[model samples]
Structures are given as structure tokens and as C-alpha cells.
Target: MSDAASTGFSADWLRQREPFDLAARSASLALGFRAALGPQNPAAFRIVDLASGSGANFRALAPLLEKDQEWRLVDHDPLLLAAQRSEITRWASGQRWHCHDHEGGLAIHAGPARWLVRSQQLDLARDLEDIDLASCDGLVTTAFLDLVSAAWLDRLSALLVRTPRPLLASLTVDGRRTWFPTRPADQLIADAFLSHQGGEKGFGPSLGVRATPYLAAHLAVAGYQVSTQSSDWHIGREHSDMLLNMAQEAATVATETDPSCKPAVSSWLADRAADIHHGLLSLEIGHLDLLAVPHFPVVK
Candidate 1:
């Protein structure tokens, strides 16, 4: 339930899926990110996150990084931007970290390490060129790439070509959907849902499932050593609420994609709902996580 759907996702939905995202994210690419950014050891690195809804990227990546860091979270939604400070502060408090608000942003002190987190409001689709990629040590985005068209991704790759940086784009859907108790309509609904994914998420008809591989090729042509891994979501019986929400959303999107599929989609949802209540339904959603770095010039 990230921006991959092309929707300006609700903050509540963001909160709901965060734990699943944390659990499903790729492990190796995180190590790859660490390796990519570790050598610049003089001080904390400045990282920019594109479409950073409520600083979820920060909440996830900050602790994994050893150095004190400065982060910029960019998104078009003013509401989510405003929510970042309160949410992060609350989250840190739960972890016993001391958080303080300053003139510009919030600072979290976790024993010896401190991180400065700030949010910027911008329409990345319209202002991609306005971002100063050269100023940051790296770029990050999660559940965002699938919302963009191939041309938009090419623009990004071209910028990174000029100013090489470590880029971690994670949790993009790869078009695979599986449901337990395997109803006959499962594939039809999934097909329609995938079709709906391509219908304009403010980036002019997204590539949806093709996003990761498309970006990987583009960045590779720009001299980036691109790597990818599976970051599939495994929703089991424990997440009945999330599973049901996903079912409803899928049905809605499927109907929008193909009006003729409504009857089938409704039946599927009803069956899935019953299965959910009976603790019999589950899902495996396929997503990809990508890590890219300049292979040519050695950050000189």
C-alpha cells in the first residue's frame, strides 16, 4: 500500500503497512547500501529520500546506518510532511531515544549517535530537475518507483549519471499476487489490479511491474552498478485486517480497470472475506528492491 499504486496514500494506510514493509524489505541490499555509503567516513552523509511519506524511509534506515546522518524527506503532501516530526518523535520515544525539536527539524539522540531529520514539500513529478542530486551523498525511495513511467525513471538515471550517488529504491511491485484457498477468480482479479497499476499515478501512466528492471537498465547505461532482490510481502492469517483491506482495494482497482470484471471481482472479495474470517486466507505479493551505484568514477 505504498505510492506504487499511484495514489497519494493515506497516512493511516502508511502506518498500517509499515510493519509489513519492515518485515518484507530485502536484507542484502541494505548491506549493499551500507557498503556503498560506508567508505565516505569523514562524517555523516546527507541522504535525500524521494516521495518520502511520513519519513518511513528514515524510520527504517537511520538505525541501520552507523554514522550520524542528515536526512531530507521530500513529498508533495503537506499533511504527511507535517506528520513526520510527531510520528518520528513518538516512535523514538517508544524506543527510549531522546528526541528534540529545533528551529528547522527534529533531532534524535540514540546514545552516541544523533540524526537530524527534516521534511521538504515538493511535487517530485514536476520538480525532479529542481532537486540538487549533486549535493547529497545518496538518494533513497521506497514503494515509489512503480508509480512512475519509464521516461521519468530515465530522467532520474540521467541525473545520477551526471552526479553519481548511491540509490536505493525499494519495495516496488513485480506483478505477482498469490492467495491461499486458491479461488478460480484470483488470477483475474490480480490481472485487473495489475492493469489498474498502469493507469496514471500522477507520473503519466506508470510502468508498474516493469519499474525495477527498467530503472536497473537505465542506471546501468549511466555507469551504475545496479543490483536487485526480491522484497515480497507475505501476509498470513495473523494480518486479517490488512489482508481484508488489501482485498477490498484490489477489488476496487480491478473494477476500475475492467468494468466487466466487477461481478467476478465482487465474488472473489466475498469469498476472500469469508476465508479471512475463517482464518484460511493469505497472500504473497511480489516486490523488488534495487541498489545502484556508480561503477565508473570512484566518487571523485
Candidate 2:
């Protein structure tokens, strides 16, 4: 598989959706923008969301903004872009416009307006030649960044520094997943599973504790003001079925990389699954939400 496919994570894995619940908490952090912007600001605002999957951020942001705000949604996946388009259409009716650039995975749509879907992947670490940065006012993203390397973020920060827009990026990293609501036995298995999952990526060895703080450092280096909020998803025994499946996926990765880990991980998962079947296991997912802003150089 190519780097894109290997590093690419499916939002579909979020199907069981503890991640979505964690993601929704970002809405409050986004809404806090009003205090920063002040109360008297007009309803009309223009914002862009990158890597928008199923438009989760969009749905959360919509109710908080004026019904007339122009929203441009961009994602690299065609299916996700289509899903976002449908969601906007369904909720806002024909009031807002949508631009679906399927070729480049770029969609520029606003109110009652025609949209163009450009199928291209914009590397955050690279220069954005086709995108006109001057036209945008606000920037938004959610649950992205962990997939990117340091060099990529450097390029992104350089671009943001050059652009005049203030950015609102919400990055959710699994900070406490290993220590979340779980038994010591299960937690040990999960740690091994996550450790192995990290190895699947080329830079796996250092990524265990690297994602969150690294992003903050990169953004700060690029001159972005940053703040973070933590969100937790606590699931009771009732939802262990979904947790079991997630655990299974993680365990599978561990068992594949380290044969020695196979026996313990497999046994732990088996017991966990049995507990779920009998309504005995409860699970919790932990996430960290970061808010970052690009230091917009003042127009002289």
C-alpha cells in the first residue's frame, strides 16, 4: 500500500462512534469563538474545514453561526465529501450553497450558489498553489494532525502565517486511552495493542507519546497561539460490544507484529468478548481536544 493508504485512517472505524461523541465536545470550544470575536458580530461568516468527514464539525458549527454563513467544506475522500454535501443539503435546505470538487477532493459551496468539486489532495506541508488564501476569513479542522509528520506541519504553519485568516483547529489525540476505564489486565493488553499498532507506521517507535505535544510545538513554532481542552467518552457495560470490536482490531495489530504478544492479547480479548456477551465489561475512551490559531500577520 502507498503511503497515503497506509497512513490514511478511516473515519468509518468511528462507526461504533465513541470518537464522534468525543468530537462533538469540540463544538463548545468552537462556540467560544464568539467571546473572542465579540457579541455584536454579524451572522454572516465564511469558514473552511479541511479533511471534513461526514461534516461532524460542520453540523456542530452550523447552529452556532448565522444561517447565512458561507461554509466551504474540503476533504480528500470522495465518499466523505458526498456525505457532507448531502448532510448540508438536508439540514439547511437550499439556503446554503455547496461546491463539490470531487477530482481534488475540494468543495467550495456557499448559500444558494453553485459548487465545484476539485479532486486533489492538498498536502499541508506543501505550498497551496491553487487555493486563494485571501478569500477565506476563518479556518477549521477536527480530529486531524496525528496522521501528519513534523515536516508536514511546518509547511502548514508557514502557509497559515502567510494567510490572513485566523485558524480554529481541533485535534483529538488518544492521550489516556491506555489508562481509561478498564481493568489492569485489559489495560495491559490495550497498551500492547496500541504499541503494536504504532509500529505499523514507519515512525511507529516514537509516536506513542509524540502526537499531541508535537503538534502544539509545531504550531507554536509557526507562531500560532494554542490552547487545549480534554474530553472523555465513558461507556458502560451496555456498550462493551462495540468496545470489544475496537479492542479486537487493536489486538489483531499487536498479535501480528509481536508473536510473543499474541497469546496474552488473544486470551485477554477472548475474555473481554465473553464479558461483553454476558454484559460484564465497561469501557471508556479518552481524547484531548486542542484549539490552535495561526498568527495572522497584520496587513500593513
Candidate 3:
């Protein structure tokens, strides 16, 4: 489960899901970004990543954006922020990028592209406006919207109003999780998990599945043209660890929702575990990727 309330974020989960997030994000949106940036502005591309978890969004989008880039990764978790530098270095080494530790950030050169990544630990709820969006060329986030409230979205919209920028928000859970070969307690557990998604993640009454629409509407009102694409995670039986973690998270939430459901949930977990062990279980998780481009005032 990507949602932090249950399984939460571990190094294991982040590592497991990174490649899936990269593969599932809308490639066309990268084209949109290139077009938005245009060939004229060939100097520097500055982007701020919100709720950055170990810099997965950075690792995904950097190579795609063939430009000299600067990224400011923001998150509330100091521990995650601390991991950013090491995680990025490890990723760079794997890609065989010429990496160097710069004063303000990590400097890396891959083929013709150069990227500098920096980490910031900030309380986004308190400092959303405090972020210097006008200086940024774009904004990006992944697997984050479902954990925030409508009010938080409103604050974001208001900020975007001041300085219109291209935003690529990806991998948000849209409330669909399918366990293959079907189980009897699937719906009950799924319902409780969804309920937990809406509870709170430091933000009030998280929109969960309902977040995408609210965020889209707010962006539209702020003079942004919004587009969406499905960025679902299809977990096959081969990836046993993630599947097991997700199953465990589901049972945890279900039992918490209704204590009496423990027996039923336990049986469900056992069945799911066996299916996973035998490589029989598969999962389809619904997620949405939203691209918002501000309609800049046409100069007469």
C-alpha cells in the first residue's frame, strides 16, 4: 500500500515502486513539458517536487527532461529528506552518470544532460505559499494527492494563481485495487482501506479517490488547462514482497475499522498469502496522473 497510514513508507516500498511509477507515468506529459519549456528557453529548467519521497520523482523525470535542470525536493519527513542524497547518488551510479557532490546539491551529467538535485525538509501545509513558485519553471509530485485535504488543494490553487507553471502530478491512487481470482472478503477489506485513506495524513479529511477531480477543478479555476491519464500499478505474482505488504496493510486497516472483522480478515490474508506464494495472486491498483498547464495571458 502506498498510503502511509497503514504500511507507510519504507525503503523497501519506495525501492519496489520506483520503476513502476516511472513506467506508468504519462509519457505524453513529458512531451507537453518539453513543448511548454520550448526550444527558446534552453538555459535552465527549475522544478520543485512536493512531498518528495526519497527522490523517486526526480529519478523518473530527470532523464526524460533533456536539459540543464535544477530540482528542489520537499517533504515533511526529515528522515526521508536525509535519504535523498544517498538515494540519488546510488541511482546515478546505476545509470552511469558522471556524478559529483556539489555544495548546494548533487551535480550529475548523463550524456548531454546535466542535473542538480537539492533536498528541503518543510511542512508543506504551513509553507506551501512560502515556496518560491514564481522562480520555478514547473512543479511535480507523485503518489501524494490522496493524502491531502480540499483546503490544502485550495491553498495550492491560490499559490498557482500567483505564478502559473506546468505541474505534473502522478501516481495518485484512484480507489481501485483488484486482487486476482477474487476473494470473498475483498470488498470489505478494500472499503475499510479506502476509509483509512480519507482519515488524515497530517492534512484534514484527505480526499483519497476524490482528490484528482477537486485538484483539477481548482487548477481550471486558476486558469490552468488540466488533463489526466491513468497511471495504475499492475502487480503480478512475481513481485511477492509488495503484494504481501499490500495484503498486510489491507488487513491492518480492515481490522482497525471493525475489530470484529479480525477473523474474516485473517482468513483473507492467509488465502492471499498462499496465492502470492504460489505465484497465483495479481493486483491492479487504480491511479491517475494529472497535467496542468497555466494559460499565460497573451500579450497584445
Name the best candidate (by lDDT): 1
lDDT value, residue 192 of candidate 2:
58
Per-residue lDDT of model 1, residues 1-300, tens digit only = 534333878788889888889998887897788788864687887889999998888989888886788899999999899889888998999999999976598989977888999889899889998888877888999988988998899889888987888999989999998998799998888888778878788888799999999999888877789999999999998899999888888888888788897888888889999999999999999999999988875463
Across 1-300, the per-residue lDDT of candidate 3 in tens digits comes to 356444257655788788778778888976686566553676778889999989999888888887899999999887788888889899888888888878788898988888988898888877888788877888899988888899998988887887777888898889998999799899998899888878877778889898998899889877888999898888888889888988887888898888998999999999999999999999988899999988885111
Q: CA lDDT, every prediction?
A: 0.86, 0.55, 0.84
For model 3, give the RMSD to the true fold.
Answer: 1.9
Model 2: per-residue Cα lDDT over 1-300, one tens digit each: 111123554545433452445444656667655333333554445567776666666656655653345566666666666565555455444455454445544344455433332222444333334455566556677666555555555555666677745556664446455423455566555555456434433322334335567666767777767776665566566776566666676566556656686778778777777777888766655556666655555342
lDDT of 3 at 244: 90
TM-score, candidate 3, is 0.95
Q: Please identify which of the two predictions, 1 or 2, would achieve the higher lDDT against the true structure.
A: 1
Native-to-model Cα distance after best TM-score fit, residue 104 in candidate 3, in Å: 1.8
Which segments of model 1 are wrong by more than 4 Å? 1-6, 298-300
- The predicted structure with the larger TM-score, 1 or 2, is 1
Best by TM-score: 1
lDDT of 3: 0.84
